[model samples]
Target: MQAVKNRNSSINSIVESVFDKDAANFWLQKFNPLWSFNQALGKIINKDQTAVDTVSLTIQTNKKFKLGEAGQHHPVIVTVNGRCFERTYSLTQLDVDHVLLTVKRVDQGIVSNWLIEKAQLGDVIEFGQPYGDMLLPQPSSPLLLLAAGSGITPMYSLIKAALKSNVSTPIQLMYWMKHEADAAFKAELEMLAEKHANLKVQLFHTQSEHPDSRLNESYLNQVSNLENTTVYACGPSGFVSTAEQVFKSAQSFKSEAFSLSHLASDDVGFINVTLTKSHKTVAIPKGQSILVGLEQQNIQPTHGCRMGICNKCACNKAQGSTKNLVNGATNTEPGHLLKICVNSAQSDLTIDL
Candidate 1:
C-alpha cells in the first residue's frame, strides 16, 4: 500500500518534529529494510529442524509480497553483528498466508549456520524477489525430475505444484541421497505419490551396503519415457554432473548444481575497475568477484544471495566485459546487468556499483 510506504515518512516527520531528521532515517533503516522501497520482508512463525544441519522455515510472509514460482528461490536476509547477510532459499508454498523455505547448512555457511543455530521465533527477516528457472516442463512434455541430497527441496515444490494443478503431464522423480534415513520430505513425497497417480517416485540409496547405487545407466534404463522426457535435475555438482551425462539423450535437459566450481582466470593479472556511483577506481584481481574486490577497498555494494540466484547483487556494466563464475558465461555489452558476486572483471570495467 502506498499508505504503508508513506508510513515511514509519517513516522519520520513525527520523530523529526520532536528529535532530529538524521536520527529518524538512521534508526529506521538500521532496524528495518522496509524503510527503503522495493525491499521484501517476512516473519518466521515456526522453524523445524528436519534433519542434521537442515531447517524448514515457515515464514508468515507480508501481504504485499508477491509469491515465488514453483521451484524458484528467494533471498533470505538476516542480521548478525549489526551487518545484514543475505542468502537464497528455495520457496515452497504451504498456504495462502505462509511459505516454506528449506535450508541446508553448508561448510562455512555464515547465514545458514545462523539460521540453524541462532534464529528464534518471531524473528523478522528481509527478502528479495524469487528467481530461478527450475520449473515444470510443458504438459505435453513428460518430466524426469532428478534430485540428490538437499536438492530435493525444489523438486518437492515442482512435484506438488504439478500434482495440484492436475495437468496430464506424467512426472517421474528419482531422488538419491546418501541414505534413506537422511532424506528430507521422504514421507511427504511418498504420500503425494500415493495420492497422485501421475506422480511416480524412485528412491535410491547411495551409501547402501551392497553397492553405491548412484544414478547411472542402470538407473536410466529402468525409468520410463526417457526418450520423451524433459529433464530437471538438482544436486551436488558431482551428482548433477553424473546425471547430466546419463540423461544426455533426453529430449531436453536443465539442471542446477548446488555449488559452482571455481574457475581459474585466463588472464593472470588485475583489471582496472571503476565503481560508477562511488567514483572510485581499483584493481580487481583476476578470478576475484567484483563483489569481493569492492569489499577489499571498503566499497560495500548492496548484495543478497551471493550464489548468483537472487540477483540482489546485480549491477549494470556501463563499459567493458565480465565473465560469469557460475555458468561460465561472458558479457561485454555496455549497460549489461550481471551479478557481481559470481562474476569477475574480464577487462577494465565500469560498473554501476
Candidate 2:
C-alpha cells in the first residue's frame, strides 16, 4: 500500500510539472507565426527521395508533439546557409509518435533547397502548427482526386486515413506528372491500390511517349459516374483550371490549387482599390502588385498562395475598383472580386486588409 501510494504521488507530480501554466505558455510558442516549435531531439527515423523534386522526412516526436489531422500541413522552419526560412509541407502519414512529411524542391525555393541539402539525421529544427481546410470526404461518398507533381503530398494523407479506416467508398485518383521520375509515391500508390480494392488510379503523363495524355476535358468525359463523385484537386494553376472547368461544368467539383498564381492572359492590368474600413489610400503602381504595396505599409494578411489563385489574400474592397493584371476583368463591384495578389490599383483607393 505504501509503494502504490508513492507511485501515484510521483505520477501526479510529473503530470503537474508537464502541464503547469508556465510550461503551457512556453509550449504555446510553437504555434506563433513569428516563433516555432522547439526541437525535441528526435532522430530522423526514415527518409526517401520520393521524386525528382520531392523527398520524405520522418521524424520521431516526443510526448509534447501535437497530433494533427490528415490533409493538414505543418510549417517547417529551418535555417539554411545562415538564412532562416519557413515552408509548409503536407503531412503524408501520421503515427502515435512520429510524422511523415513529403516535400518538393521548388526551383530556387529557399526552404526546399535547405531541406534537401542540409537537413540530416539528428538535426534539431522547429515547426509551426498544422493548418488547412482540405480533408477527406465522408466514408459513404465516392471521391475523385487529382494531383500534379508534388501536389500529391496532401492526397497521400487522405488516402492513408481512408484505407486505415477500411472505408467502403470508392476513390478514383488521377496523378499527372511530366515523367516517371517525377511521379513520387508510385510504389506506395500501387501498394495502396493492391490492398484497397475500391481504390482506382490513372497516371496522366503530359510528356509521355505513349497516349497517356494530360488531364483535360476529354479525359474527364471518359470517366464514368463522375456526377456522383466529389472532386478534389491540387496541382499547378493551369492543371487546376482545366480540371475545375471540366468537372464543375459536368458535375459537383471542389478544388484546391496549390499553385500560387492562376491568372489568365487577360487578367493583367492596373486598377484602383479602396479600403473603406481603414481609410488608408495607396497607389498600386502599374508594374507593382497590390500585395507588395500593402506589405510596404506593414499590413499583413492571411495568405498561403501569394498569387491570385488561393484567394487567401482576398481583401474586402469597400469602395473604388481595381483591374486584374493577367485578365482584363475589372472589379466594379465594391464588395466582390477582391484578389489583392494580382490586382493593381489604377486610381486612388483605400483597402481593408
Candidate 3:
C-alpha cells in the first residue's frame, strides 16, 4: 500500500506541476496588467483580533471590482509610521463588496505590525485587484482542504462559497495548528459541519494531548481514499512543504505558500539557468535568489508572497541543481528546488520557462 501510494504521488506531482505551469501562465498574461491597473486605495473599517489579527476594508472604487477565487490573495499596501510597505493577505470574504483580511504579526514584520497596531479606521490603504490561480476545484469534485494559521483564510472562503452554492460533494478538512487559540474559524467550521452532511471537518493541534502528533504519515493513513481527493494547502513555508509531500504521496495537492522574506540567507552558491524559450543563459549568484535575478532581467515571474511562502514562484528545474532557502529545499536536493523566490542555485541549472 505504501509503495502504491508513493507511485501515485509521484505521478500526481508531475501532472500537477504541468497544470501549474499552464495555469500560472494563463493567469499571468490575463490578470497581471488588469490587476495592476485596478489597484485602489481602501479605508479600514475595523482592525481587530479573531484568534489572530483580522482587518476589514471598505474599498472606494468606481470601477467594477473583479471577484476573486475562494483561495486567491491580494496585496495590501500601506504606509506605517511614515515607511511604505506592501503585504499579501489571502481573501477571506470572496465575491463580496467589501474586503476582509486576517493576518498574524510576526516579530519585526513591518506591514503586519502596522496593520495590527496603528492602522486606524477610515485610514486609506492601497490595494490591488484579486489575482491568484490557487482556486478551489469545481463544486462537483470531492475536496480535501488543509491549512494552518492564516492559511485558513483561503479555505474559509472556499467553504463559504461551497455553502453558498449549495454544494453536495463530500468535503473533508484537516486543520493543524500549534494550539486551539491559534485556530481560526473553529466555531464556524464546526457550524458548517453540523449544517451540511456532506462536509466533514477535523482539527489537529500539535501541542494538545490529541491522538495524533501533528499531521504525519499516521494521520494521512487514516484519511479517506486518496484516489478521489483533490488537495489544497496553505500556511508556513516549512509546514506547507511537509504537507505537500504527504498529500502528493496520497492525492493531488494544489498549494499556495506565503513565506518569503524570512527565508533569505547568506548562502554562497551558484547555478546556471538556460531559458529554453528565451534562448538565454543566466548564472544565478551566491546569496542572491533566482527570482531577483530574473526580475532584474525584466522576466517578471508570477509571484505572491515574495518571501518564498507562496508557491507562485515555483519553477521546474529542468536540469542541474539548486537549494531551497525555505524549508531547506529538501525536494530539490536530488535536483528539484521548486520556488525560486527563496532558493539559490547550487550549480548550473536549466528551467522550462
Root-mean-square deviation (CA) per prediction: 5.5, 6.9, 12.9
Residue-level lDDT of model 3, residues 254-284, one tens digit each, is 7776664345566665556788777888766
Worst 10 residues of 3 by lDDT: 31-40
lDDT of 3 at 281: 84
Task: Please give, for residues 1-353, the per-residue lDDT of candidate 2 as tens digits.
Answer: 99999999999889877766555546664553223233332346677787887788887766545546777766666777786665667765556777886778888888777777667876655655666666776535787888988778888888888888788788888898888888888998988899889998777777867747777677766567777777877876667767777787434665555544545433334445445665655444554567877777676556645545446688777666566654445676666657777676655556676
lDDT-best of 1 and 3 = 1
How are the candidates ranked when ordered by TM-score, highest leading?
2, 1, 3
TM-scores across all candidates? Answer: 0.76, 0.76, 0.69
> Worst 10-residue stretch by lDDT in candidate 1?
32-41
Compared with the true structure, all predictions reach lDDT values of 0.80, 0.69, 0.70
- Top-down lDDT ranking: 1, 3, 2
Off by over 4 Å in 1: 1-41, 138-140, 205-227, 236-252, 263-269, 316-321, 329-336, 346-352
Q: What's the lDDT for residue 319 in model 2?
A: 66
Model 3: CA > 4 A from native? 1-38, 52-64, 94-96, 209-212, 249-251, 260-304, 307-321, 325-339, 348-353
